[model samples]
Target: MSYQHYRLEELARLVQGELVGQADLCLQGLASLELAEPQHIAFVNADKYVEQAKVSKAGALIVTPELQQQLDTHQNFIVVANPYLAFAILTHVFERKHTQTGIESTAQIHPSAIISESAYIGHYVVVGENCVVGDKTIIQSHSKIDDFVEIGKECFIDSHVTITGEAKIADRVRIHANTVIGSEGFGFAPYQGKWHRIAQLGSVQIGNDVRIGSNCSIDRGALDDTILEHGVIIDNLVQIAHNVKVGANTAIAAKCGIAGSTIIGKNCILAGACGVSGHLSIADNVTLTGMSMVTKSISEPGTYSSGTGALPNAQWKRAVIRFRQLADVPLTQLQKRLDHMQTQIESLESTLKLRK
Candidate 1:
């Protein structure tokens, strides 16, 4: 939790914030309002957290202009247009800098693999033949890079990660531990009462500035490469099936599943635990709320949600029972009754016209 100290004035200037106290106040690290110490800085973004900020022990606070107005005029704080954004910037400054460089002796490198001198290859890492690991990249312990894979500069591949099937990764990508890239997708053909597996011959292409969280699986394509556009961020435990194309700057939350060949447009957000059916096309800037299920293609860009929110167990059981009985309802008889009523209405109208 150690941090390099910075002056209050300098910190405010770095985040484009307005200072309200002594410029020389020494700040060491960032913390939540409840956990902040005398030398730490905290933030209060919304009115709900104002009470907590007022009693916090932090030497300095970062707050929005509206929130600052409610605080004491003499309080030591920094006013920013977006307090959360300012706090995010400070997190980078507080993170510990990595100093390890050079390949570990225990790492296995193939004869045809190209390793950069500045790259850090941790113990037990295997670089396959014809693979290119770019400058300053870090491949942590127990990770395997298969043949012909290309990883760009400044990428971080965490421990126990597997990259195979000629996967191509661009610069500044961060793949967390236990993630499997270019794995075979679920593709089977039914023939003569038996199931046959299809040979997956495609690879995966990841664009720059993408961060994939731990325990996620991104499968390779059946023929073409599965593509992830630049600036994509995927949360933990997500499943991306074969030949799926995720557009630029899309953020997918944890536990989401995208079926094979689905094309998700740019800037879309799929919330946690959502599922998209196979081969569906999702428009750009679409937002699917948590636990949504998409069985059809979305052509318009807007927020979408599905599934009933939380309900009591008793009510949910009754609803499920009602839904199950819908198939038994006699729709043909209902239509016949409606047709008879329409005939009677036409007869009465004719009689009224004759009397007039």
Candidate 2:
């Protein structure tokens, strides 16, 4: 990939940072302070990294104005209020150099499929009959888009992704590699002493700007649609069960399992390995800590947590015994206190009557 030079002032404006050094200095790419070359740009967010920034061979560095005074300013500097944020912006600029563009000739697109001319179909991809591939959507290698699937414009379906039949994915959605969408949910009924399979006829409806990470499984609804609202971001190895309705902008971390028919509210954050029970309603803005087992509905927006931390075996045994005894001890103490208070009240009432 050919490196593109960006002016220091242009980079500062792109990241919304104030420029302090020579604005006309050209930065080719971004690199770590220690590894930066003359064509690359580096950043120093803390005093600890200032030494590396000073010795770096990079043409320019992004740093806070306070830290710039401590370092060698021989190389041009872009002074930003937040150097970390500026670094994040420059990372994207450098990463775009490796991005793929246009369709490959070896891509296996079905004749019946309505793929937009602007879409990029990569190698060994299979687009099934009656599918609609939207404008500027890139379907990478080994991806299988099943029949009746609709992918909206500007979406990035990464390599080895599988979108099963009737799945509807909206605009600007990004699905990482090996993620399975619209698979059959776990639904069964006991009929005549045998387990009868319940057909999962409903499809998955994914909203715009949603990002699903690698190896995630989103099961199709059993009877109604399994819906993920706009801007919802899900991490790797997450299992979203049948009929699960996740509200807009809710971010769920890796290894979380949301059971069937659970309605998770908007802007909620479910941390890694958290298990949410079926048919429960989780209120908005609720944050579930890592490894939490949510077995009931959470109506309030406040942070709630359950699960005991690990301790030494001997200490844990003693703690368990005390925990069991607490129920009886509290009642016994309350009864003794109530009896003493009653006796005092009677003596006070008798004295009051005598005085009257």
Which has the greatest TM-score?
A: 1
lDDT tens string, model 1, 1-356? Answer: 45599998988999999999889999999999999988998988899998888888999999988898887833788899999999999998877866688989999999999999989999999999999999999999999999999999999999999999899999999999999999998899999999999999999999999999999999999999999999999999999999999999999999999999999999999999999999999999999999999999999999999999888999999988887786666889768988999999999999999999
lDDT for 256 in candidate 1 is: 99
Number of backbone-clashing residue pairs for each candidate, in the order shown = 0, 0
Local distance difference test values of all predictions, in order: 0.94, 0.89
RMSD of each: 3.1, 4.9
| Candidate 2 per-residue C-alpha lDDT over 141-166 given as tens digits, one digit per residue, 9 for 90 to 100 | 99999999999999999999999949
Clashing pairs in 1: none
| Candidate 1: residue 248 lDDT (0-100) | 99
What does the lDDT come to for candidate 1?
A: 0.94
